[model samples]
Target: MNEQLLKDLLNQDLDPVETREWIESLTAVIGADGPERAHYLLERMVDETRRAGGHIPFQPTTAYVNTIPPQREAQSPGDAAIEWRIRSMLRWNAMAMVVRANRKPGELGGHISSFASSATLYDVGFNHFWRAASAEHPGDLLYIQGHSAPGIYARAFLEGRLTQEQIDHYRMEVDGKGVSSYPHPWLMPDFWQTPTVSMGLGPITAIYQARFCKYLEHRGLIPESDRKVWCFMGDGESDEPESLGAISLGGRERLDNLVFVINCNLQRLDGPVRGNGKIIQELEGVFRGAGWNVIKVVWGSYWDALLAKDTSGKLRQLMMETVDGEYQNFKAFGGAYTREHFFGKYPETKALVAHLSDEDIWHLNRGGHDPHKVYAAYHAASAHKGQPTVILAKTVKGYGMGEAGEAQNITHQQKKLDDSEVRAFRDRFKLPLSDEQLADVPYYHPGEDSPEVRYM
Candidate 1:
């Protein structure tokens, strides 16, 4: 098939059967050499499908990266709570922009893209700290990265802090409509995210907030408590001079009440943040030198078995040594590409993962996506004393959305998803409601009407 014809076919909102037919036809003509080649082609076909729908391929907008929640039957009460919150956060991230008027011109509407991957990474820490805080000892969140506001709003909405009407009016300037911006702390009484245009201000602000708490306690103005000031920022944001300029202040003041959660998705708005995956390691030294306790949370459950099997820590070294850009390429290119990159770069590591398929290697768990790892990091941060803490959690941008936006260089600008793509996304989360039902539902509802939805 010609490129134009392929694009045309992909643009159409074809059902699964038609999509398969087109794929089969293309493979027949292309002469599929093996299952891996066919799988790669299938991925390319999906990309075309997204492009046809006006959703830019490899973009990081909500339409491109907002995906279904990962399937996990909760293992414990804590796990169940975390899963419920994560699913709720994902649902809101997906529905937030879709409810807005896409036709609006200029920059006067809900954001086209929400920081889906970044938000999910930090949600575990956010939920835990928020739940534990009380009116007397109030813990606050310092949002360093501006793009992640939607996920914060999603968590708030599920926690009953926001009403359905308010959610429906998100980005609308009308009297009760949720006033839209990257983030506005004034809109919410309890939260304290000041609207910031640049990166690094969050770290500075969080340090000041922590210092203020200390001042209040010393003066007997407030009771001494374990309340913390949690700041969330991207590793890309760390490259900004403003982000790192205030590092010394945290250590100088001995702000143990401060906690920094760096979402190491490793991609800035432009491209990969670091060539090798040493951004975390590099930051570790910077923070430690500046007098902060740096905690690295890399490798999720997927690496558990592999690590357990490694007697000499070869797999861990391979993982750590894998370049960040190479990892992004693996994600953008898919399973076969990752297998080739991993095994090709380190021939000796092949024996460690040889039994696994290309698909298995590609599907390895990321630290940010794994709730258990995130919670554990947060728990450790809370227990830490004497110095400020930083959790360097590795993550994937456009993580769950599949081929449309994961790890692509162009994710920041692309926006909006077509109907079929939306339906498929819902199905992945097991929220397969009919078009009629979805249409009839209000912008925000109790969600009891649908088996899988429950955000209203």
Candidate 2:
């Protein structure tokens, strides 16, 4: 969970004293029965610097100090500077631990051994599945669920299809000195992301957001013979008028080989609520009425909930009969998995992913790709549409990040960890991967598929 979550302040946005006033108000609203209710507001102050990318706003209310460590624990000039190097290594390895913990071997195509190196968790997850499956099933073009057209664009950038420098230029730096990344420093995201933040809500910009998808629809970006496109966009974006218009037009114009993933973060602004979080359910209703092939996957908090509910017979009916495999390929991706509960996910390659021990499962499907559920929907849609498929993944926001709440907290970013803290986090969270262990880990190539892969 080595990332931040955004908290949306409603009604009146506060500043310092004003913020304190609101915290008191919120505390009252939460009432005495709610334990530590004030913590949420107080917590906001600790991470202000993260608000605009990294232009740190100096630590919030002084009262926050007790709850969190001092931001400027002015050490003796001799002490803090001296430990900087050691701290840096720890931070680097800590990040690597998160990366490694997230992926089994080969998920990222190779043993990056460090998050400090330039690879994303999505990349790791996608490649891991691809490589693992390729060992058994060759010729499967690695199909993926994109969170947004930008995500697909980002993948293209990662695959060496785009240069690092260009992507950096395209990206805006949120922090003071732009952003700094390690392990192949140049491979930063081409954009800075703030929750629910966007350039515009207009059709043109919506179209821009859906840009890569247009290429996907027209068979413009990819080669037709190879596998088609799998595009991922967030839940909010799923409802954009322009996106819907594009899909309708594409369908009317006969766009094939496109897979859409509407990642349901269960949110509107900060995020959607639990239980009824997915946006696709509504969209599915519309798409189906239009004679479009769509599959709806309402999954549970763990793989078991999903697998238990998703009996093989139901899956066959969904994939083989519902949509009738119309387009040769069409799918929807959704499930409840989160990294918090199941980090370093390596699900049992057998059908009983539901029954496996917590230790054996590699996925924490809080919100990420669930190949089984998603691919089943893809099968259904592909068969029904008579066109290749779009596996629209309804996923959770902040899928792999540390914070589990809908609010991506800014305070949790570990900019620095003293000796005691660093040691503890290391021992508790990140262990190391062995050479032999690494060799057998899942490796991500591309277009690889597996029916019996373990999924926890």
Candidate 3:
């Protein structure tokens, strides 16, 4: 196209359809004439637009979608069904541990939503990425988010590392047998590798730990190996200056072995974290600007079909435009509300999801809850070289707790579930428990010889 024609096209306020056609035409031209000429022409158009005092729309540095496309995603190496079952069991036990503890006379407090939100994030790592310390290898160092200790304890219980009695004593560490409320090295020196309950400590410590690993290698104190430091933190936790203050150091030092997984559940203790804005986008700009490799896992596999069908990009536009508060409301209110408020915003967007029912929409998940997506991001992050990698995974706080919490502001303090909520939780996970068993809030464990045990 000529310069004047290009200028005219840019000046017009094209609708989505017209914009798509223009994009297709430009792509065809780029394919025919090669990228070099296309780049030059685009730069010239930008310069001309600026010279004419015309406003150019700001393009986001990242898309509001999974950084790794479906085609490029790594196939999960493990049996997904088995892994999901194990994860469900862990999630149930973790919630039950907190619920049962809170029901006691002392009302011992523990966290449910933190672990609930991060189950898949942790499961993917345990199944495919994280390594235990051993003689043969230096092993991966994990700074588990302090509030997520219950989930870790639940997994240990399944592995025969902790007895049922210890599992029963959550947040009762004053007695010698009980587990600590958070990951405290001094409390359980043999088990806990790091103390991370202080909110900002985990992120800073993990950065230094990764840097120190390189220092040890340089000093010839340890052989150069593929040991990684995995730091898990919440979006709220990132608000702490200590959490984000030293990220530039990790980038500057080229701590390729460092991986920070921030669970962007869009929630803090009181309410939504960045309620009016997108936290994932904000953090992406920060990390990428700081010279780090940032991978975003926003939508789950359930969204792949819808996104693929969004030829006009209307669906993505809606996703980008919607704020965190609205997103959390969509989860809290369920599918029917989401259809009306989210897709119903535009005729084109509404028609896109028209074939799906309310139940289908409600079941659609976020990336952090999906093992395949989480695994793909983890796989890519592990292989990434030069810069540190940070995975900004979107999830729902109090994921499966239903009305008792799920995505609510009260989720952080939700410890006990009433009879109906208990039943809902049971049915949601498809736990093999009867209605009568709901009252007791018993921890369901398949026998040692069960397939779940063998798989674990």
Candidate 4:
């Protein structure tokens, strides 16, 4: 931990053993891969070493990313190309910092620092897909943005195709002509957590609970209604004290319309005693037991089928029929507890009945819960009735960052990336030669601002 030792470590020559250790450690922190374009951060590590006034220490192994499933036997044909395009573009965004850093070293290192916040990701994510989704199935999503995430989101959407109305609204505010500036560089919605949490949760966490109730009542998905509301979340927000408790309450209240998509890859906010230990342990199991449909898609699997064009059609069809608000109750178990057998256990635990004549998902007109029974009653009542909802996904921490040595937690993440490691990762993103490709391009950096935003 001393400066000399740290410097020495930075200067150390790496072997296969050391290289593997370094990559795994990075993956644990970044969660998915740092950037798919990079097999290793080659140039950045050297830059980091030079900045440290030492030699680069850690190195990367010769490995390839395999985040996607093969498209050979797929019902879809273009899924493969689309999948790769997505990966490459995401990776391109990741290195936006380094690519832009040369203009202003360390100034525009926005993606990593800016991205860990749930608010920022939400806004950016919206910008990334608004054109495709909103233009297509307008009714399917009513995306909400409150804090830091929404600001990024708003900007991202504007960048895609700026409009006079939209631009006028946000620009007035960021500029003096408006009222307040966007929350911090990052915004934390109502339930957002601020720095420091050693004691426990406070007011920010309170409103989060209140809004959950309101949002669910207002916009929740009904089996027959065919609507879905997604709450974009950050690592800090994910750790909110009341979050899981509220999610359980949602299930208890039969709010199957609510879907929680948590971004869990950031290491800075994810302390050890929390992130994987408590957060994942609780959410991964919480709602499934209480009559909720949970789908945990991690790695490249995060929000894929639902957002994809070719697959979106099938996804919508499956979801609509599944929730057609018939005359029966059903329980869906996905993620960790998924199996083919839960389909039959309904006969004994039938505590509820479906009575609705309208279209709805999990449309329960009547149900009886034994005061003596625990969540088991709800579990049985749900899984027994309707077509039965299913939790489609769950992911391992750091799904494909390629790190295996360290536990995916915060304490380790607090440490800085060494020079050699940075360089290795930067170089790994180098694109293959193409005769027709443009001659002028930009460099990739992990901690620099984006050139794509400027001199494009």
Candidate 5:
């Protein structure tokens, strides 16, 4: 290709169709010649464009879609029906534990939104990704977020690792039998591994842990193994300097054993983490610039059909242009508002979703909540080498909490749910509890012979 002709083409204001054709042609030439030659030419073009002060259009670092294409994604090995049933049971117990504690005279409070938001994130790991320590191999290390401890406890109860007495004593650690609100190695020395109750400790420590593993392997202190360090944190937690301070070290050291999963629920304790901006895009640029593998799990499987139909790119353009504040409101207000405002702005975008009902539109989930999408990202990260990996997963703050707190600014402090909210939650999770059983917001456990129990 001639340099001047390439410059002229770059300067032209081509529409989406023309741009697509130009890219396809360029890709064909690259494929015929070989990718290495094309890479050299592209680098030269970038340098020349900078020297000439000419504008160059680059692809966005991330897209409003899953990092892995549907065809390339691996199928989840676990049975979906059994896994969902187990997740529903855990979600109910976790919520019930917090609500029951607050009803006491002391009004002992615990975080509801964090766990509600991240239940699927944890559930996926438990079922497939995370492994236990054994004589043959070292196990994966997890740094659970401080606020999401309740969900872990609920899982333990179902596994028979925790007793009902411990479940009842949430946030009242003074008693010998009571459980601590956050992960504490001292309180539960036999169970909890790392202490992450402090806001920014998890991320920094997890990075060093991965680095330390490499150090031990090089020193011949431990056998060479594929153990991984999994760090889970909130989007708001990233604001703490400690959370992102050591990410550069991870990339520089080529710590392929490390995987950081940041749950972006949008809302922090007070309000939106970045109401005016896109946090996922910002983080993507930072990680990619640092020479780390970045996988974005933005939209869920529910969006596959609509995204496929969005040939004009208008729908995606709207998704990119919308701010976090508006996204939060769309979920809070429901499907009607989302269709009216999100799609209402452009007739072409509106028509793309015309076949779906308001209810269908409302249930369109974020990527973090879907097990298949989460599994794909995890599987990819585990297999990727030569760099660290970060999965920026988008989720709803108060995920199944209904009007009590879902997507509301008051989520962090929402410790108790009313009778109607409890009933709604039970129904949403498809729990077997009747209205009468839900009256007390009691903890539920399937018998030992039940499929859920046997599957676990």
Candidate 6:
């Protein structure tokens, strides 16, 4: 296409028919080598127009973006209010964890990023599991990966379980620490009930608990329906031999009341876990072979439309074939770097995602953050009979911690949040307070009479 023709297309407001003709003409000029080639040529033409001081009209469209579920969107006033309240709670809970960690130095509550993701995942499962099984008889919640006790603490604090004084004294370096840094069954309050001895014991203990429940049921003690146990473990924890060692017991005992929710954050304390890209696949095989049901929760709805367009399966390959290191780089560098690295690895994907903006790609669906998907997976696990169920939920290690820790390998031990980062966090969450007010009342309570506060 000549510079003159490009200028003409950019200058005039064309009708739909005229725009279609322009596109055809441009396509013919570029030759139908492939959709990628045509797209590249068009982009090059647009860049040339911009360099020549002409603004090419690039109208953004959601056609390429996945339509999020109605629950995810605030469609009505009530919906918006509720959504706003939820977001505030998440932000508040996250900040409370970090701030408390910062205040009580050497107490080691600073798994802010992990705690953030953990809180979200637990929040979704808590309501469902509580209503499904716990309300009648006390259900077991085993904390296999106990480093995230602060996350649960934050949630409990928000829900009025922890008093302002209790929140203030959490993990204090001094004598009288209200809460332990790790999830200790004897230390923390309700909801965060069970504690594990070591890294890989969650599933093992859960299986035994379910078996014991079966024994009780057989003896005409507790009902079989109230025998549920939910075990929360991390991806890194899954690597331990003991993690899968007793998993066979579930099948042998037919512990249908047992459920394991694996937080697949893709990183260990040292670095990314081995076979990172294939951990879920490997776990699926192990569980299936052991006579258990496995549910792999990977990408969210964001990739649905894009994947549907790729009939040849190249995009799917790109998604699965990319090494774990590449995903680490994506979290470290952000969208532009990942786009270049990802497309460079699989050039065939250019045709699939070429039209998408950097923001669109960056905002791709993550299963951990999607409450709907998490809730659904929990519901499915609850309903499954015979063998136990495992939910492999994909999540970022340091999600929502901003550049401080998100997806960074070293985030596991990253406990301190600096002043500037704290400010940014506060602003991002839109807390209704000034810096002075935030400092004055770190544990601000909503008005007692307010429905929002009462509801929480």
Q: What is the TM-score of each candidate against the true structure?
A: 0.74, 0.37, 0.91, 0.37, 0.92, 0.76
Q: TM-score of model 6 relative to the true fold?
A: 0.76
Model 6: clashing residue pairs? Answer: none
Q: Mind giving the per-residue lDDT tens digits that candidate 3 earns over 1-456?
A: 875457457668456567768778779878899767777888888989989999897544587999999988998989988887888889999988999999999898889999999999999998788888789898999999998999999999888898788989998878789898899889889789888878999999999999999999989999999999999999999999899999999999999999999999999998999999999999999888888999999999999999999976779989999999999999999999999999999888999889999999998999999999999999999999999999999999999999999999999999888999989888888889999888888887887888888977
15: Cα error in model 1, Å: 66
lDDT of 2: 0.34
Candidate order by lDDT, decreasing, is: 3, 5, 6, 1, 2, 4
Clashing pairs in 5: none
lDDT per residue as tens, model 2, 1-456: 311112223234445456667767877856864545566655675566466466654321121001111221112212223222222222333333333333434332211111211122233234332222243332222222211223333344434454434323222234432222221123343332211223123322322333344465368563323233344444455555554665554455344534454444444333232322224445555554444455444432353454444433333233222221111011111122312222213233234345555443433342223434433454444344344233334443332222222123221222322344334433443334333433222112122132111110
Tens-digit lDDT track of model 6 for 220-247? 8966564568888887888788888888
Task: Please give the ranking of all candidate structures by TM-score, highest first, separated by commas.
Answer: 5, 3, 6, 1, 4, 2
Alpha-carbon deviation at 130 in model 2, angstroms: 9.6
Best by lDDT: 3
User: What lDDT tens digits, residue by residue, belong to model 5 across residues 226-300?
Assistant: 999999999999999999998999999999999999999988888999999988888888888777899999989
lDDT of 3 at 195: 85
Greater TM-score among 3 and 6 belongs to 3
Task: Indicate the worst ten consecutive residues by lDDT in candidate 1.
Answer: 60-69
Residue runs of model 2 more than 4 Å from their true location after superposition: 1-227, 273-278, 300-369, 375-392, 404-456
* Candidate achieving the largest TM-score: 5
Candidate 4 TM-score, C-alpha based? 0.37
**Clash count of each predicted structure:** 4, 75, 0, 60, 0, 0
**Relative to the true structure, how large is the alpha-carbon lDDT of every model?**
0.64, 0.34, 0.91, 0.32, 0.90, 0.67
Off by over 4 Å in 3: 1-60
Q: What shift in Å separates residue 377 of candidate 6 from its native position after superposition?
A: 0.9
